[model samples]
Target: MLRPVTRYADDLSYVHHTGFADLARGAARFVVDLIGPERRRVVDLGCGSGIVLRALTDAGHEAIGVDLSPAMLALAKRTAPRARLLQGSLYRVPLPSTDLILAIGEPLNYLEPDARPPALAAFFRKVARALPRGGRFLFDVIVDAPGRPLSRRAWAAGEDWAVLVDTTEDAARTRLTRDVTSFVRRGRRWRRTRELHHVRVLRTVDLRRLLRDAGFAVRVRTSYGEHPLAERRRAFLCTKR
Candidate 1:
């Protein structure tokens, strides 16, 4: 079993094209619209590098970020010194009272099936205890489709890198497994990395049901509106009742 590798800011500059700005905008709009006057305190769940949290704070909203990757958090501190960053997993968030909560960039898609209920329950419990009535809990994930090709073969074009990855789905076990191998050439040194990610694939209906059970009502489901690049994932916006 392989675990996901953590990427630092320097690494992110080379890997992610938009970096964090694209994610920040989407989350900011959702939180501002949902929390209205109460959007003072925003929690960025799975806040890799605190990009969204930083954006929210710059816009005058207080922000807190939680992530499992310490390497990423280190970079986040340099960029968003005003926001509080905590080292923690999405399944367990430590906070009290938030105007809005966000888990963007397909973090929730990484949970396994049996683990999802508990994770979602934990998220809901934390948000419920921290947020007042009518607060918002928003998240997004890549809709799972079995036997789908994620990319082509591994290849490098100049300094840019690309690879093909896929996830294995076990219907009987309700389990989804992700595997990847990527390599980047730095000067004369060739750096290669591989990771194994195990996630759960909840049906659309089942996901909604879990949210409802967690004390939220469906607000909207928006297809990512970014430059055709985000067409690969689905975004779900839910609100606490």
Candidate 2:
């Protein structure tokens, strides 16, 4: 159940491979610390470029990476040659029995508002069936802030490529729209690509409720590491009860 990638997928993968390795490394470390030396099989949902999977494998765990974008999967294959990689949609991807399932990098944000609950429920059911009683699921979500001002951001990769992102929220603030434009150097010429993305925002209470209904005992942290205040991005650690 794979879907076609957005126009920005190629440039996004390129940027991730070139500059985002440290972010992935930090996430991997956080995950490792949280789970300890269990030596359990790990599955990384929406595993772009297999950075986390690579780290897990290096730490002596059997790791598998799953993603929908072919461009991302290609980079993952190159970056983590020894790790197993699969390309498919999260909703229908068949995964092996695992001790930990990771859905990082804003994968859930991509679902529409109405589809979020059902999709999460289905995902939880699948994980419940695939994992043992003490298995764990770790994920992060972006908290919604109503009336947030629109903003535009940009990033560059030396002289080869650049990406511009314009973000705006819906009137009700339940959905966020991002218009992205990428400029890439192609030999003597430059190529421009544009893509529009719509993401839904979820409340912490609703997310906790959904996980509870799906048979998990959930704990949330404002940040992955120690922090004094809650941040927009929150992480959820769920264990099968």
When superposed on Cα atoms, how far off is each prediction in RMSD?
A: 4.2, 3.8
User: Cα lDDT for residue 27, model 1?
Assistant: 60
Tens digits of per-residue lDDT, candidate 1, 41-103, equal 888887776677767777778888887767668767976889989986766656767777788
Model 2 TM-score relative to the real fold: 0.86
The TM-scores of all predictions, comma-separated, are 0.75, 0.86
- Model 2: per-residue Cα lDDT over 5-78, one tens digit each: 23327876776666656656667888878778868788998888888888888888888988877889998888
Residue runs of model 1 more than 4 Å from their true location after superposition: 1-14, 17-25, 29-39, 112-118, 144-164, 170-174, 185-188, 224-232
Q: Which candidate's lDDT is highest?
A: 2
